[model samples]
Target: MRILEVEHLSAWYPSGRTRRQVLEDVSFTLDRGQVLGLVGESGCGKTTLARAILGLHRACAGVVRHAFPRPQMVFQDPYGSLNPAHTLLWTLEEPLRAIGTGRKERRDRAMELLDRVGLGPEYAGRYPQELSGGQRQRAAIAAAVIARPALVVADEPVSALDVTVQRQILDLLAELKRDDSLSYLFISHDLNVVYQICDRILVMDKGRIVEENDTDTLFAAPKHPFTKKLLEAAE
Candidate 1:
């Protein structure tokens, strides 16, 4: 099933005396349970594409259609994304509470979510500052999935962690994808990381997608010059 479809989508930002286009005629589709990687250098409109898809940015033209309910986002900074003052349980319960879940059910669901993310009930009582980087990220992931969102937009989800921690978080995400049958719009500047987790890759340059292909095909033989440059840089 097609979870998301974007056709001729465009976005622009106002600059000095003129409106500068940040996304131009961008388009793509994401299927249920598929992992689509959006790869590009900084300021290449990668995040703009994500924001537009999530309705965080206003589009200039075209359409973004999705079969799912509102999608969730996992930001780059784990610590910053979470509330510093709230307990982990409280953080996880916010979504459930928003949907009118009862107090007893919310507590039970929060504990279940913690278990699913490989954390224990004890950690739920701790603050964001009390946990390690990996633990905090795990909590963030748990929060993102607690509501069982159909699609998740993870923008550089593991970019701030150490190499070992990065692997752990990536593994956790992959496991969650399988367990939940979730579709992900995984955004990153690192081709290598994307190659490891993404089924397909989209290469963005300036403000457009220069190339896109299955992960194996793109890695073995990149067609576009910009794609080749990204591959070379990754190497």
Candidate 2:
């Protein structure tokens, strides 16, 4: 099933006194269990496109249709994404709590997610400031998938982590995708990183998706100059 469908989406941001377009007529569909990568350089509207889909950025025009409930986002900076003052338990439980879930159920769900992301229940009481970068990203992932969201918009999820930690986080995301049938709109500038988790890829340049193809095909034979350049840079 198609979990997400974006059509004719165009978004802009304030620049000087005028608005500058960030995404232009961007359209794509993400299947229920597919990991769709959005790849491009910085300032290429990747994040803006994500925000458009989530209805977070309003200075835009387009249609973002999705069936996923409470779509989640795992931002690039895990440290900033999470609240420093809140305990991990509180962070994990926030989603369930928002839905009026019973207290016991929320706690159970939170603990289960903590373990699922490879962060043991022991870390639940700790504040975000107390966890390592990798630990914090794990917690961020846990919170993102805590409610079993059908579509997760992960924007540069592992860009700030070390190589080993990036690999671990990628593995964890892959495992979660398998376990929950999760669909990810994975965004990043690093083609190598996107290659790890994305089943398909969309190449964006200058507020437009210049090319779209399956991961294997895109990597093996990129048609667009921009896409080819991106692959070359990653090499």
Candidate 3:
């Protein structure tokens, strides 16, 4: 089933003299249990497209439709994304609280989420500073999935971690996808990582999708010049 559909979406930021387009007529669809990788250079609007889909950024035109509960975001910097003052438990519980879950149930759910993300319940009592980068990211992932969102917008979620830790986090994400049948809009510059996790891929350039194909096909025989460059760099 189609979980997300973005049609002709466009977004812009105000420049000194006029508006600078950051996303132009971008469109895509994400199916249930499918992982769609968005790959591009730093200024290519990958994150902008994610924000537009999540309503964090204003879209100048087009439509975004989702057939699931409110989509959640997992940002690159786990430390920055979470509230420093809040315990991990509080971070996980806040979503339930917002939705009117009972106090006891909130605590129970928080612990459950922690376990699902590969963190123990005891870690929930600690603050963000107490956890390693990977652990903090696990907390962030736990919080993001606490409400069981239909689609997750993960923007460079593991980019900050060491190689070993990055693999662990990627494994956790893959496990979650299987256990929950989750759909993901994974944004990353690393084609290797994207290839490992994503079933399909979209290549962006200057705010537009320049190439898109299934992972195997795209990796074996990339069609776009930009895609060829990315593959060459990954070698």
Candidate 1 regions with alpha-carbon error over 4 angstroms: none
lDDT of 3 by residue, 1-235 (tens): 9999999999999898899999989888999999999999998998889898988887477999999868999999877988899999999999888888999999998988788888888898899988899999998988888878889999999999999999999999999889898999999999889989999999999999999899999999999999999999999
Error of 1 at 17 (Å): 2.7
Write the candidate numbers in order of decreasing lDDT: 2, 1, 3
| Better structure of 2 and 3 per lDDT | 2
List pairs with backbone clashes in candidate 1: none
Ranking by TM-score: 2, 3, 1
lDDT score of residue 149 within candidate 1: 90
Write model 1 residue lDDT over 9-99, tens digit each, in one string: 9999989889999999999999999999999999999888988899999747789998988799999988798899999999999988888
- After best superposition, candidate 3 residue 102: deviation in angstroms? 1.9
Poorest stretch of ten by lDDT in candidate 1: 57-66
**Model 2: worst 10 consecutive residues (lDDT sum):** 61-70
Which pairs, if any, clash in model 3? none
How do all models score by TM-score? 0.96, 0.98, 0.97
